[model samples]
Target: MTTDLLSLKARWADLRQQQPQSRIRDAAQQLGVSEAELLVTGLGETVTRLTGDFRELLKQVTSLGYVMALTRNDVLVHERKGVYEKVSFSNHVGLVLGPDIDLRLFMNRWQWGFAVQENGRKSLQFFDPQGQAVHKMYLTDRSDEIAYNRLVTRFQDSQQSTELAILPAAAKEIEKDDTDIDVSGFRHGWLDMKDTHEFFSLLRQYGVGRQQGLRLAPEGHAQLLSMEVLKRIFAEAADRQVSIMVFVSNPGCIQIHTGPVHKLATMGPWFNVLDPTFNLHLNETRVDQVWLTRKPTTDGIVTGLELFDKDGQNVALIFGERKPGKPELTSWRTLVDDITAAAIS
Candidate 1:
């Protein structure tokens, strides 16, 4: 039976040429073959095992370029660059795969579909466990843009549906928590700047000099500075500078370039200490904002000034604050200075 089906399907080349729009049922009727036999021949055993076949097809499609695979259990998609992204069709798991692209496979309860746009963008749409389109996403040239679009689209599409599902809420909460986690970490580091000279020296060593800013790589934002490095910078700042003040605000993620050269790395626990909702718009104005906010503390009485440093092992953040002539200012300065020094060292 399998041999006959293979032969019939193989002969489909000539048959399709003769009857381009012919359905397998129609062909079966004319040939006196049972509709089941014709359908089996047309789709083959692979179609019966949809999950396995889809996985195999994805492996091949990804090899060619980007591919999105959908199955009853899960959805796996990839870009031409070999990034495989996976999302659970069920409520169990969701994952974005590949800094080192790998072949991924999984399961769901219903079959999946994929579509690609003319502009090289890919969209993967899948239903949640509650039959809501929980994963509606667009894959663009930029990762952040893609993620943002996907999040927005999924939220908007699900908004009108009568069947309210918990997945959307879960996803939004996850994103919010991620942002909070990043800000919290940055605040912790920014508040810790004790040793001024050592912090600056470390920055110089790492080629991030004072008065010059560095831009990090887009992907580098996720990488975290080691606690050991943060500790060392604080210790050094405490030793040399009269008053070490660390100001961290708008703690988010960033890809930065340092000095005149555009060396890149994604680094952050960014600080927008003064403002929680500040976004780092890459421009001279934002740079001025940061400097203006920190300058008063560093000018005059604070002889040594340094900001932002990283030894091979850790990143150090240090800056100087003006010494207070008045006892009140002096007392406040000491308190802040000690807090900064202790947190980092």
Candidate 2:
């Protein structure tokens, strides 16, 4: 006999009462269950599984007005407060193009969704098949709670069942299955790249991972940076008032913040950007390697600072602010140069 979701939820409810401050992700980890599995356990109560129209729900969510959009990986968490507007989608990819909340979404990985409430805090959380959160949107006091209520009512599942078909999580925290990699082809692809977007195709074509490709990149193309350089970059950007681009992504979505960042502070093992509208919390300890990579583009040779975890997954990417027609900003390039120089000094 297997334990039902109701029984499991009752136990979870009890555990939550014991430790009120614990987050759902941490609680799910403690229970040896996917976050989605733990979340659905509260179906018909504080949580309602969104119906088959999860994709449509994401599109329609823009009508809810002001909301806080959150996207994070294991090492970095990014939260932006704004409205979801100018929303458009193709077959597989979607975009939320508002000034404050901008995201490039990979729609295929969106597996499960729930409109959830706990202790008066309400949010809509979406997860991948492996039970990791892809993105979350929380309603704010300024947000249209009325529209939120309407959307929930419209998308609420008819069955109101708690059972969810969750896929088994990966055995290893990081995938290291690299074999038959075409190093030469990958190098050629790198040297031949005309735009940064083509890099993903290069990785897929050669079946090479991001870190592995960096490790095997042609000489003069990539250099591993020191961990200390990150703090310096943030502080210098603040002091110089240099507008830069920060890209943080998970498997499902990439969130971008472009502008000057002030109030770069470190609290224990975390590196935080304490800006008013944008917040980025990065686990400094998990950053094993930082790479300064250069790629040739039509504008010129563009440079990027890419941070990766121990498992070769990208934590974040930083680049000088530049538009399509213009070359990279000299201030941003000078900042990177200063950081690179400090690393050697």
Candidate 3:
């Protein structure tokens, strides 16, 4: 190990001694380093660096059988347990459309892979060039250990270096002032949108940030939501037995859970959905803004409840589940409208 890595390990050891329960990601944050940088300190011991086309590596994940897929951003974690199936990649994008293990992967952003073993549990973790985790798949008791071993053997990097090349953090982009944005033209294009995906193009065409677009939305298109209303929305969804889509994503991957959410609870700062196949843990306290947004789609006006953190980063997006040719569920729209009216009152 280099002198720098040795010093880091010593500091990490001291930190772990002081806070044994701290997760590696949290510990990395507390130590002012990327999680991958901290993780590489155990290169030869617990982490085996892997190199190859990650898309190809992931295509072989089905052989491992049942596993737990985890993807998260700063405030929300989306976990689903299922076998990897129906994976495909086209250039820079990929998809895992399994009945249970659903994911939308952006291959171009995925840069590093590591096979990690901790406390007898194993996982395949992937990260971006900046060393932030993009996605992780943990091997369950039912997973094939032999297959996992075979995978590591096939892709392990030749050089087991303890020091990871940590890239400098990217500078935040400065968005244009609201005064400079063509708010009227943006609203017109938003009204003309036929699919929800076109919203991104609208933002780019008008040089508008997402929240700014919401702020400048046509009258009745967006409503500022009270933070307290978030819990109520969940309670209403569960009570109404409404199937919804919960989207949580980082830069490299987006995980979606499309079904009814039951068994809601809160512990400290987290609001959780403890379900049999899907789980979500949201840091409610970290949410700084909430909005009820509407967009015109060919099927109808699609609605979503959006959450954002203090830095204007999206935390999560919840929408009523509906296929392309189907209109928004009446029950879901009613539930939201009722909640919005109650919050207003």
Candidate 4:
């Protein structure tokens, strides 16, 4: 169906009046349009098309003092509140390293940008070619409003069209049968894993995808788990004050949260970490599979709880926080052991 801006604006107004608290992304889906398309319709009113160099603009975000960086996929939203510090870029890869506002950006996937205002709230939102939000920066009361205005004015796209061209979602890679892989070689590589980073290369060498690799691994290496495992892991970590790393990614970027998470709740289809500096809203309903995976690393056996969606896309990765030259945390390893034993029993 074709989208008409005037009609869509009217429809959006009616919908907003009916459900004042719904998010724009949700409302856009309900209206059968892309979220970026919906935001484009507000071009002259509440949205300003942004242009100039995205990288340059990102480099200057540090001037804003304190802001919130948000990245998500279909099932998870990761938000970090702090100043954008230590910004650097190498080709299409970008990094924001600091105690807060950490990010890994595949810069080339950033396709669209907008400066939006609603009910006196403002933010800089960016999207990929397929209309998936790659990242967002929101100004807080402590942020430098003057810096934000300067950057917006400097980079405002000359076109500012009220129409958007959103590409369709890419098809998922087809899963391969275990019989298609060299089982003996795959097993040998699994046994030889010297670090978590080596798993990717092993998958490449075995001509298999990540999920396929797990499925093909020997029974003792990877075991499928129930959704209940996630709930218990969070509760157990909170109770024990364990620092864990939660990795969530989009096609264009991966956002990592490292520290202790205590405020966790599940409401309807969403699992939330309603913390002060970091917030994660994960969609438990979209979860299709959970795997308790043990990978051999130079440090020792590294265990992680991996969640996958129906399309086989990794939804989230949960691992105990540990640096190089250290074995997995004893408590986390014990928790994994107990969970695995319980699942088997």
Local accuracy by lDDT, each model: 0.31, 0.84, 0.90, 0.86
Rank candidates by TM-score, best first.
Answer: 3, 4, 2, 1
For every candidate structure, what is the RMSD over all alpha carbons to the true structure, in angstroms?
Answer: 22.5, 2.7, 1.2, 2.0
- Best prediction by lDDT: 3
Better of 2 and 3 by TM-score: 3
In model 3, the runs with Cα more than 4 Å from the true position are none
Pairs of colliding residues, candidate 3: none
- TM-score for each predicted model, relative to the true structure: 0.21, 0.91, 0.97, 0.94
Cα error, residue 276 of model 1, in Å, equals 31
lDDT of 3: 0.90
lDDT, model 2:
0.84
In the range 30-55, model 2's lDDT, one tens digit per residue, is 88788888887777778987877566
Q: Pairing residues by index, what is the TM-score of model 4?
A: 0.94
Residue 35 lDDT in candidate 2: 84
Superposed by TM-score, candidate 4 places the C-alpha of residue 39 at a distance from the truth, in angstroms, of 0.8
For candidate 3, the 10 contiguous residues with the lowest summed lDDT are 160-169
